[model samples]
Target: MRTCYTGEVNTQHLGQTVTLFGWVHRRRDHGGVIFIDLRDRAGLAQIVVNPENAEVFATAERIRNEFCLRVTGVVQARPEGTANSDLASGAVEIVCQELEILNASVTPPFQLDDDNLSETTRLTHRVLDLRRPQMQNNLMLRYRVAMEVRKYLDSMGFIDIETPMLTKSTPEGARDYLVPSRVNPGEFFALPQSPQLFKQMLMVAGFDRYYQITKCFRDEDLRADRQPEFTQIDCEMSFMDEFQIRDIFENMVRHVFSTVQKVELPQPFPVMSWTEAMQRFGSDKPDMRVKLEFTDVADLMREVSFKVFSGPANDPSCRVVALRVPAGGEMPRSEIDAYTKFVGIYGAKGLAYIKVNDVTNIPEGLQSPIVKNIDNDALRAVMERTGAQNGDLIFFGADKTQVVNDAIGALRIKIGHSEHGRKHGLVEAGWKPLWVVDFPMFEYDEETKRYYAAHHPFTSPKDGHEDFLETDPAKVQAKAYDMVLNGWEMGGGSVRIHRADVQSKVFSALNINAEEAREKFGFLLDALQYGAPPHGGIAFGLDRMITMMAGADSIRDVIAFPKTQRAQCLLTHAPSGVDEKQLKELHIRLRPQEAKPA
Candidate 1:
């Protein structure tokens, strides 16, 4: 129990005797006066002890970083020039009349202010790591965001409702984390990847509007922005179409940003279709802050003698995209090679380029090893199409449509933000919120020769495209929309299929036959048949949102207990072996491992 937080003490509280409790952030000594920085989640406060109080001074001098303590001190103004101008409590110090060491700490494995600590070490000592001020602030910001989201939705007549975490698993793209059933032999319940099905069912049940800040689990590979278990601001509504849903959530998002981050986001974010985004930026969730963009050159290169560009250009399914970097000709060849290697990771065969130095002479103007292979006419056409000015470097990506989009899109962001782009005046410094809509209902996997839902099966196909579902699934667009902040996809949703026939058609388009559909989603189909209302909803990655709001690089830093990239909890040593008896109860058995020789 404490009367005042460290960062709250000020001139107004001078001469006031108050009780404080916190860990000693740091300890210092100047001659006979002992100083300790007491820290709480509120922030740090300076506590000074003088030889006048010999016992308190002795106790303060013994304190070290992370030593938990309780203190009774008289607040007083700091000596002139000794004030910390950067701190809220800089004007005053707590003169400790009493000091009680509640708990002593062993030296931390790493200091609180230490930079570049390995993720493993930080995670292993997460409790101490969480005590760091930045971590405290991030988690607090996360809490504030959740509260504001709930408030905004609540004001909009959205009821806070919960869906079951343990439910039957039907494929929703990613693998689900399953819970073995003890009562039912050879059965399992899955942690929801999202409340997608349940939220839609709620609309069918006529809840009108429902929202939940729920946990979602996926047994998938990890990344900087992902966790095996994550949170979503899940929502759904009945009798609402795409525009209404988008408007409501957009305002909610703006409300969240304004209230929590003190940043006012623009109303009605910019919109682009899935096709346009892919063609120009190579990503549905494109970062508009970066100035680099792709221009189509497939047609111009189709008749060229160079097979590298001509081969893909001639194929209708492939694409050829060029990115013009302003004043990029000055870049050294080594940097260009490094970028070529970077694009190769995205299945690019190679990055082709022509450096524009002097446009006056067509042949002598360009400088690149590939310049000889590119016909002068084709080169001139590309230069004209891309508006390649002098001192610009035009990088080309030629491959399957998706491959070119992925590689060139990624290259755009990398080059636009890289040192060269900044030097060339290409990188812009601002945030741009956008909406990427009209996603295709199905994306055909050329490898598997099967069509998968671009968003999810429940997402309704756009009107009149119902015919395209049977005739041409590739051309079927969905009434889906995604909210993107700068580059990350903050949230996405679509109008749901409230009709049984339509839902069944979506299932069939995804290669799910009637019998299998009944086995997997019978309840949903049956519900649709019985008075399901037209509805739609969105799910925002709460961790990802908070990560951006807190300016944290990884979602892991904002999470209190995050698993490793390999999905192992370093602190708890999770995913440890289960005893044979427990497995027997769940009617499961594992194959025996071969004996190892000692």
Candidate 2:
């Protein structure tokens, strides 16, 4: 309820009279004169009640932090010594002609600028927490990003279409959050994990292109970047192959990055196969910004005396790789121990390392406890392969292929952060984006003894790889691709399987027989028979994408009202018990919950 935003009034509006309504961000009293910082979402403006204005002065004196007020004042240049160059409204201050306190407030539970408060306490007072400038800026950036997404897609002839939020339960790789039905008692509807099937159906319905920014829910555990409910920028197209699909979306993201974040991502991001990514960086989502990469010493280690190196070297399913950390020879023993412990979380049994102390001679440069366990030939090979140098340290992970990759990959990222990209919660000046392509169509789940789709069941197997679906499922690669930025996967999609026979073969490879496949995805199978066009599209996690763009530590910082890692909303107290009458209306029965001891 004001003439203009606080930030909108600057030197250009000097001497103009205006009315502002906002909370008191900060209040200061210098002798009899009072100064208060009036804050709205746009930003903070300085207001001063001169001593001569007795009525306004008295009211300003009574105002405390966070007190809602309406002020009518004439904007004027601030005193030379009082100017704040850091703020948009810094050069001027409002000379209060009148001041009215619309509402009074007690002190906030925590200071807006203080960093010591726990996340729980901050979440409990989310309304106030969001008032902090950082949160406000994050949400504003999120808004701009979303709008830019719309602008880009619209310009590209993408029509915005909505899909059902309450749909039938389907296998979507995550447990669905079910809604009990009222009219159809004993039945349930599941919240859409994604509009995956609906979007495909849109393509089948002859909608050339479609896009939606919609909510998706999953009854899954949470993490720094995950939530019980999240937003996705879902899109689909018809008659476009994987190349055309990737080009359109890559340009869309580039446009958004240029428009929203003001960063121009490099065109035609370097592409690498999933196999190559795993081999070099030990992760399908590699942060190439990091100078670190692994060297395969498996061949040389096959005959070494060190069992830790030689044992895994001979196993076809295991790998012996080394990471050469620059200037790592200076790391104290305790740091190495801590690093060893860090890799342990990813299933690595132990960490093996060799410190390079001298560059003049290979044998003399090596200085590690296990130097005696490895032959000179093996040591020289590792040094040559990884390009080790004096003052560098080589860390080794020899285990099952996945475990080795996961552990070393994680270490590589951690080191990159500890050295660059960001420190604490602040990001630096550069970014790296890449396209990781050619992913395996299916992955063998050793625990379940079954193959699961790598990207999804709908992803089409490559032309020549279709035969391998039946003969060698492990070797079949899908025309799938992911857009990764600064180590986070911004989005992913693939050419979809439109042929029923190919779909059935994929289902069979995943061990889902004809009957089970029909039962779960009968509608999709039915639609394919009626003629579905060749199509592929991508879905981006808006939360994660915005988080990376904002350089935020977690997606929660970008989400308006996020739950804790336990998936409980502190602000709304969601997941609360329903009344007995309500449950009866939904035809539900109550079960006793086990009590936990304090």
Q: Which candidate tops lDDT? A: 1
List, residue by residue over 420-471, the lDDT tens digit for candidate 2: 2243222334778889999988888879999998878999998888889889
As a TM-score, model 2 comes out at 0.96
Cα error, residue 360 of model 1, in Å, equals 2.5
lDDT of 1 by residue, 32-97 (tens): 888899999988899988899988887887888899999999999998989998888888999999
Pick out the ten consecutive residues of candidate 2 with the lowest summed lDDT: 419-428
lDDT of each: 0.89, 0.88
Model 1: lDDT equals 0.89
TM-score of each: 0.98, 0.96
